[model samples]
Target: MWADMAADTRIRRTGLLERYHATRNFLGLDSCVAASAKYSTEDRRPLTKDILFPALRQVIKTHPPLCVGLANESSSTAAFTRLHTIDLSRIVQFRDNDSLRDALESQLAEGFDTDADLPLWRIQVLGDNTVIFAIYHIIGDGLSTIAFHASLLRALRDVPAGDASPLVQTPNTILLSPPIEDVTSVRPSLSTIFDEVYRLFAPKYLSSDRKAWSGNPVPMGVNGSLRTNVRLMSFPAHEVTAFCTMCQTHRTTVTAAFYVLTVATLSRMLAGDPRYDAISSTVAISLRGAAGIPKDAICDYVSAHRTYPPADPRFSWPAAAHHAAKLRTQKSKARENIGMLRFLLGQYVPFFRSHLGRKRASGFVLSNLGRFDASAVEGTWNIVNTVFAQCDVVVGAAFKMNVVCDPTGALNIALTWGEHSIESDFVESFLSRFQDAFRGLLV
Candidate 1:
């Protein structure tokens, strides 16, 4: 009984990642989501304990996402305990590019850690001196993980080095949640249920014949067979600024712009079939800031938000912006972000829903972390180019596009798709064409 109370200190109560994690366990899929940040330090020295420990201790003390355990996993529900004493030596480190790639690939391929208590996040050092901090999606969302590293870097720059004291690991400090209405009791309306009907049944997608990131026909990356490839693209600081300016001009978020581009790219790859019109995409949103969660809190509040496709395939930045603006409004009005996970209580889930010929609502996910303040990581450990991405997609989402920019304005984009989607070359080709199209609009 005492153990359970101790565990509560580590277990997060409001997170939705564990629901998906438990579901993945039931369905036998790799449920892990790897959120990583790549950075270049000014000094090419090897990362040492002094360089990394401050952030490590901070993560241990405050971040609940890295502490692996689902709150609802009871004895009647596949019970598991919280990971205690995650050794920094074991949890964080530096590695070469090949080793780093192998480590990340292995992390993505595994369904779950054998040591259930093993922490989900890790740090690595590339041969070229880039620092990549990765966290399992179960604990933190796109925003939390990014925010964690930002704080870590800030600690390095702001916290006086020698003055840093060892943080006592007292995990029981729970934040008192503010008074908020019970959104769940409102119940989804009949129209909302019907909307789910269409969402569950008539979900839009690029045709199967479409080329994969490798350019060959996308492999049959079905259940237990969804192989995924990772690819990267970056826009110079100036270009990113221009894109931001364009977004400002159009009054749309960067994500909406990319969402439109994702739909348009898929359309072109599928040969402009009218069926490609209004292809669906998922936007990953962070609920912490809006929900009043502190920036320093280690909580996962990411929600898979189904978004409306671009109304017009034509390339007008303003038109795309308008569509994006509407999506932003729709996301807020629907309140689906906070309430959608309630469906997990259903007797049958997405995988089962597919047998009815209504494939579970799997679509591409576009997670835009927006921009990071790179200045903190710059003075001593300067940052050059960086990349952000999600390597694991065991969930229903078929493809993931992670976009973020640094303080320098360099836009870093990473894409990972199920082998069934298209070959890697196809992804490259698709991006080239999309860039050309977007360039035309910019000009």
Candidate 2:
């Protein structure tokens, strides 16, 4: 129909944040949102392209953002153009491996060429039942990956089994929801402006008694291969429950507790290193719920809150509680980051380029996309486990820690860093100390 054709070829201007990601993409810092979905079947049959392609087709047809690719990526006037058709064979790949870990690290190193006619997303079907959905940050955020898997699982359970004759379909007529700026108001108050200004130019010594512990300086422009180091740790359902109960007992959240744990663990691990006295952490806050965006909708609805947790040698529940209060206060005035972005106007590209070879502002970034309820879907396929991760080699943190919980209350944590950003031995030691401290606290 004429309607479908209009939708297929339409182009929409990218919002401020969306354009900011586009600028990052242009610089080859290529960040992606990747998550895993493991399915179960009573019959124990191997999942094939025949079954998955149909469900994926359904997902593509339903999620309009999936049907788009970036246009004029290197320019300030960049936009998203709806592709007429995406070759399923090129976007959806299959591998006979069961290790989602290997798949995740491999996928992160591969960036999307939005200049091409294909959509800015892909899916990797690993072994029999694990599906890893990866999308460019310009189109979606971390929680967007959760919404994607949830949608795909439902489609898998509902789409009638049959031949995968038609792997691709013409773009549908549905339009993606308006960008976050259009839906919500973000006028920065005078106080917010003053606070941001102070944070930008304040003396480093005034805020801390010691040098900030941001790991390594950012590499100069897409330094070499994009390979990264990754580590995944999971807590069983019982342990997850205990961890939540422990946090509640301490009057803090799991996110705040983990932040304190990371800060304290670093302090103890690098006790005598004279180059650093404080650690800066950036926490990603999802604004979907606050912005009235649906869970299944794909959009970049995220803001950030930065905090410097107490580096007390004796890590206690009280430290975590104090950090939690700070977190609550920062989140209460969310979207200041977006408001700050507005000041950049058309300079996002140059602004990102300027960060190359500079000391990273934060040591690490933490993102927690809380529990995903698989119980809501009463269908044949069950989501057993999930993975969420990202890496930005150009201007990102020295390392990143991403957290998510599956429907069964199992906790999954991914620690990722650009290769060479930090010493391998130091990261390994930090992870070890982190795990040990986490376990010790739950006891």
Candidate 3:
């Protein structure tokens, strides 16, 4: 629906995290993070492409990162370049899938050419009420996906009339937001640097925490698999409310409780394995709050923290409390793995290569984008469901558990894992046990 407008300008060099994600894409390890929103009009108004096309144009205009592409993709000095133009026909599409899961999986399997002349993001429309916004990991993180929907929701309700511009004319001097490093110090303390260096270079036998169990070892062959298996499970609004109340009664948050639940479940499932004495996991923490970035900003301001919890057969409140406290402290610092990335600056590609045959770093990675109140604005439209999903990476966790709450307080959980990384039977048993154990808490 939109034609190409022309202008090319280098915005800035990729940050450490940006470069790492760019390299991951270049290596075909990860594809994209996406947010899907299902909306309905309060006044029973029909949402047409005429309304959506203009709304998307406004969204693209406001979010500067949406107008960028990566340059020098093969080099350490790769930078984000403002695209010469973005053709809406190429970036946006309509799908007739009957199920949201099918549409989401389809988008997840697709990848972006970061070095191309277009922005590293696209939108897929499902039926009339749903839109999936997908972007390369280098440009935005999970929370950034939610931010896009929030902005788009506002745009959809406020689309100006008689706006028939065939092209989004981005100004030549558009200034992208400064990367996280420019806003905060990512350099580690000398002791932190030393510990990381020792941890990375030291042999496993020399380490004191060798008992921590990550899942099966990562594949090392040139043909290491990148195909992903995904499962979706959700709890209705009432159940979600009940769950939250239970969490409050236990003096823990839902995220912390899930962490403990995951660790406890793995402990039971893998108890027969003599090699595992502890369960290690990673939590993705959004740094936007700590970095003073707004929720609506479309950028990557996040970090991850690794936790090693004892593999215990029992799920207890004390463990959840401890984990919750740990997360609070981590969020306050907001520099968990960012410093490590800075230390590995130019070696991201080699760093990922070095982990080919190693045991996966963690059993699972948990990322919660928290809740979005789609009805926050009493506009003509309301967002009913919001889903956040990620494509599993080759060198990372064995599986991923992603959480996001829709407008009606329903929790949408997406379970994803790389194909062949672990036995399907193991994951199936884990899910069964997890659901059984989680229900036990609410009762």
Candidate 4:
């Protein structure tokens, strides 16, 4: 089946080259998502390079478009001809949960010290029951990672005995031509959008440089990192549906409500001003609408848009639905600016591109992955849980929050912080306040 799949594969060039270049030089930030599971039964198993490698190879063959690389002007459609895997044979056990966490943290800090090779993903089997999977951010976002994992797990479980053919392979033929005219002059650059957003929405107290800059430094003290203390709290799946229903009734979206709640919470906590209105946040919007991009080209095709709430204390809950409506409008106008700024930055000040995790702009980040279907792949293997982390941004300010809602209504919130700056207590307080805000909205 593998041979059959490979025989039928064809690759094509895409226009992602420029975008990839811009992202590489500017963001300096890589996004990765990981999921792991532990099995109840322990069985001594030898490393089956054949099984693992062939399976992955089949995936690559089926999804040949993922193999494209960033070239000068055009992307090269080719298979990842050079790829390697590592075998960590040494098995280490932790006596306590703290030990397990410490070991994992140490490994992540050391393992991913540099930018990842694009389109390449890794899988590690610590023992018979434990496994770890990680992927490069450039190729996939948090939602995409979940989708990839679900598909891969399904293939592993259901593929026929000798079937070697790759799964559904798509071609990478999409190309986005940069506009001939300079759009930056007419539209707001990402930085401008962020500045406007901060000015319009962030709390007045937080507006003070001192209040916004009050966190510790990197590498943090003995208390681990701020990210370590961030906990996830989820409401029943019905709650999300109810929230969406409320949004619909108000002519808004669940996403908009989330933003409002987040802004309200931050305004109250960081600035001690509940009446504070407006807060800036970065939202990942898909760019597959570009003319020539292939529908199936597996890549990071999303761009960030800075969103802000209305500067009105009365803009709470249903009233804030108007803000969501406005977001749709502003986002459309910001598209040209988004592309132009990215292009200009890629051409000139390339190094100052990272937007999220950098120390300079660690203000706040929110990624809403709407809803995903995971029923087909769930429980086939024990999936302990999943976590998402953003690359550290360098310049302005950096803080990240990721929200993923699965089909079952399970909502997972992953928050990442700069070790030197944000306090774990602050993060916990934010989460608690967010829940309160949600409840208040519902009422």
Report the lDDT tens digits of candidate 1 across residue range 379-436.
4654555556664444345667778786677887777765544456766786788778
TM-score of 3: 0.92
Candidate 2 lDDT over residue span 299-384, tens digit each: 88888887665455557788779878877776646766777788887888778878878778788888998898878444378788
lDDT of all predictions: 0.55, 0.80, 0.80, 0.46
Candidate 2 TM-score over all chains jointly: 0.93
Each candidate's TM vs. the true structure? 0.78, 0.93, 0.92, 0.64
Candidate 1 stretches with Cα past 4 Å from truth are 1-17, 25-28, 38-41, 67-84, 98-106, 158-187, 198-227, 272-278, 294-296, 307-313, 337-340, 343-363, 376-379, 391-395
Candidate 4 residue lDDT tens string, 371-406: 655453433432334444443422323456767675
What 10-residue stretch in candidate 2 is worst by lDDT?
1-10
**Which consecutive 10 residues in model 4 have the weakest lDDT in total?**
83-92
Model 3 spans with C-alpha error above 4 angstroms: 1-8, 42-47, 160-166, 222-224, 332-336, 376-379
Better of 1 and 2 by TM-score: 2
Once model 3 is optimally superposed onto the true structure by TM-score, how far is the C-alpha of residue 356 displaced, in angstroms? 0.9
Separately for all candidates shown, the number of backbone clashes (residues 3 or more apart, or on different chains) is: 20, 0, 0, 33
User: Of the candidates shown, which would achieve the greatest TM-score relative to the real structure?
Assistant: 2
In model 2, the runs with Cα more than 4 Å from the true position are 1-8, 202-210, 376-379
